[model samples]
Target chain A: MNNETEIRKWLEDVMDPEIPVLSLVDLGVVGDIELKEGSVFVEIRPTFVGCPATTQMKYDIESLLHAKGFDDVHVDISYKSPWNSDMITDKGREALRKFGFAPPPKGNLIDDIDVLEHVECPQCGGTNTELQNPFGPTLCRSIHYCHDCKEAFQQFKPMN
Target chain B: MNKTALKELLFKIADDQLILGHRNSEWTGLGPILEEDIAFSSMAQDKIGHSYAMYQILEELGEGDPDQVAFFRKAEEFHNSQLVELPIGEYSFSLIRHFLYDHSDFLRFDMLRNSSYELLAQVSSKIRSELKYHTMHARTWVKKLGTATDDSISRLQNDLDALMPYALGLFEKSPYEEEIISENIFGGEEELRSRWLELIAPIISKTELVLPDPEGVEPVMGGRIGKHTEYLQPLIDEMTEVMRIDPDAEW
Candidate 1:
């Protein structure tokens, strides 16, 4: 496997501490990973300026690489370009589904869709949900109450 | 406030943030746990960023570039209150500091959001949005640690006791006190302090932590006039090392 492919696989197992089903890569927080001269440089942006998961994400990345014999790993935190929901990949959406959290609803009329469009439930596949609060498990998510399931789950907000 | 007084007031607000942010950042790699480490580090970064934004406004008013204002100022020339300059004694202590300052800052920025100065008002609005998350992040840890095991609760209490005096320093009235408030440049510092106390009282009560009596504690001074603790020098040195290597280089 190419180095990028190998690192991607290792990163897939690095789950977010708050959201067990979602890995850092899946959340699209891991913006870019470059390996140069046997050293790994990983660029990441937190869900917000003060998201608590940033430190753990760095440590987990370092440890994961170290365990895989890539001893020299560096994690660079950047806030130049803010994080947005569009960054989350297709595979990440699938992972979220498998983990029992609903993936964001499919785009319909992409041009005029509001950023706060309703998120479908991964469990019962219900659209009868409302945001309970903007702040959720982490800074990037919002608390949504599924009217159908009557369950409160954290959903990633589309950062503008 | 006269222009000089306004400049001094801005400096105090800017310098305090710059130094406190630097101290909190030391926890980046060293926090006890992964989740907390990230959280603390991010808070530190936000503080610095807020400082930078404020300093930029100062620069526009011809104070100097943000870097020089942040890095090159003499220790005595810094206006940050004593609270932000103190060491981050322990994780629990740091959390207490965060708890107090985040609430205070939220109120401060909220007041600034309505400043008569349009530029300052816009900047305040942006900073206020970011402060909300900082408050939440700090509140989460404070609640968790305050109600956790016996050891955790005790540590937090002790830290709160030790830091309360310094916390009052954050509201020290600068030379421009009257003019700023009278002109509605920003709200009065005394009022801000009272509101901060009110906001934090419930949180402190919920966490089972003692709310330090604001009346009895004499507010520490001089950070508003650029006087700082011994810890600030090395912090400034390290933070500015890269910028100083080539002052004119684009970061």
Candidate 2:
């Protein structure tokens, strides 16, 4: 008896395996939900086409929906509209900062090299930070050091 | 489209991505700076994942599974360009190789985005966007290092000279280039190389580094037909060391 809205609420519980602090909903990968006849069709997009977590994410979505009694669940991957870091929700930003990652910038940069140049420390709210590397443990992150806090932090780079 | 030709094209691209991704990953903790470490590692993940997806496409075309095709393949069966398989040397060497490789790769994906093959077109479109950032990253560094100081300029120039021959090997043609072009799967590697030249020349012009005369250097070929440098087999062994230990155990 649960509708698309109800299913969406359930989806918010599906955390990204990589970024454990944020749910797929908050990450903005959960695209559209349609309840057609007895089948529920869910569309999701991966943040990166080569993201290894994508298959796991689709499986998690299916399992969560099936556990909630949606028997005929179909998950489709969408690539028509690209995923950008700006798609990350405000709640996701808070979760990222709480989880020790500097959230992606809200505004899209014309020049992406500027990404590491202006990162503020999530730990001490300090502007005195230097980019340690544009590469990180993960594809979407960069590393930086805060001079004031003396803490090294990972930043979610702004995806184009 | 000829299925064989399409598969041939896809394999080369996938193999290149896989090998380079592994090589780029070797920089994870060894970069001169932490930022560069993270940068190279990020690109490594992207490249490796790209290979995984391409392998999946091959699976759909009736090839083996992605894991088998990637991790289990012998070095001689790999179709990657020789340029990508060379070890990541000094920072200048790596950077120069990165600059040359990414320019051609970005352009290649851009061309494939409009491919007649629907799945390939879709994949290429997504990949092309990601590669845009990669090329931008390469260009920024090449410009910065190419013009920075006498020492920096000379180092980059030396690496650039050393790498150009192998870099030209990126365009080593497929036997089915005619079929590929006829079917519109790709615009052919020769076209991509010409375009890459036009694209890279301007970037080099801004820097102090001199562009090598294409006529002066003979291109290193045969990676497409499986003649790789001696370095590839060892690299592959190292990459698959863990997987080969227990082939069937699930993580």
Candidate 3:
């Protein structure tokens, strides 16, 4: 029987498949974990509803726990409290920037999409970026161009 | 609660997303530019994902499997608005349709965020945020092309004029409208239409494109109760082709 701290620590090794630099815990979508009657019950909250990574993330969690001797594991996808960009850890934010994608701004989410313009560039740390498209190659990312670095980059866009 | 009414409401919304998702995917490689290609393709995935979510709810209410329900149904068995079932005409037409469609969708989901049906409310809250990107994408392109040049402006305006009547069909009253509204499962399509107009008015007014007087526009309705365009069956056929060939095949 492992404690919550030890279980979460073990989850740190389970990285986001798309953004390998960030872990599931760091990405802030491991909704909850409950140890009941010698079984592990995990709540996996998907960052984006359409994100296919959720399916993979669930598999990874289940396999990891199963390998850890939790035979009666229950991993339920919970949208109960939904994922917001603000959930990303401070450590995760730095990891995102280091990985060349701007971490979503903390608590700057608005319903207006134009507010997405001029996200600080992860390349040169410049605020002179322009939004190329609010959509990127993936559902959770948005495209932007940095004026200072003259580079097209992706940002893990903020969601409220 | 009127379970029948709730299911009807869910089916129409889900079917709209599914059909429009197929239409959006039609632009995958054929978009005017690489970015536009990716944009449409991304949106197509989101829309289809939404329909899948809705169908999952329907299944909980005792409907058939989501895959079979989506692939096996004839066009007339679907309740999506005719606006969504139409062919992707020219880029201008598609853009206008996208703009008109997503705005209504955004508003619809936004309203559902507070639905008395807790499951629907939870799903709607998640969906509302994603749809913001869609509306924003539509607005950016409409503004850019609507004001770009005479040709762009007139092409968009013509499409805008042509699409409005069908867009109005989006609000065709449900037979279960009273039940849905009474149960607070939804805010009703008429209310959604009015809110949609308010949401889109300033955006459209900013462009050279004129909003057709919806008052004079005879809405091309009946899709809500399963009537569809000739285009819908063909689109459904294409969508289900692979699935039909191998219903039990692994992806």
Q: Supply the TM-score for candidate 2.
A: 0.88
- TM-score for all models, in order of appearance: 0.66, 0.88, 0.98
Candidates sorted by DockQ, descending order? Answer: 3, 2, 1
* Chain A vs. native, model 3, TM-score: 0.96
Off by over 4 Å in 3: none
> Chain A in model 1: its TM-score?
0.78
Cα lDDT for residue B114, candidate 1:
77
Writing each residue's lDDT as its tens digit, candidate 1 over A68-131 gives 8887999976544545556678987888777766555444322222333457776787878765
Candidate 1 residue B111 C-alpha distance from true site, Å:
0.5
For candidate 1, the lDDT comes to 0.75
Per-residue error for A35 in candidate 1, Å, reads: 42
Off by over 4 Å in 1: A1-160, B249-251
Computed on alpha carbons, the lDDT of every model, listed in order, comes to: 0.75, 0.88, 0.90
Worst 10 residues of 1 chain A by lDDT: A107-116
Task: Give lDDT tens digits, candidate 2, residues A29-98.
Answer: 9988999997999998788877878989999999998888878999988765667778899999999999
Q: How does residue B117 of candidate 3 score in lDDT? A: 87
Better of 1 and 2 by TM-score: 2
Better of 2 and 3 by TM-score: 3
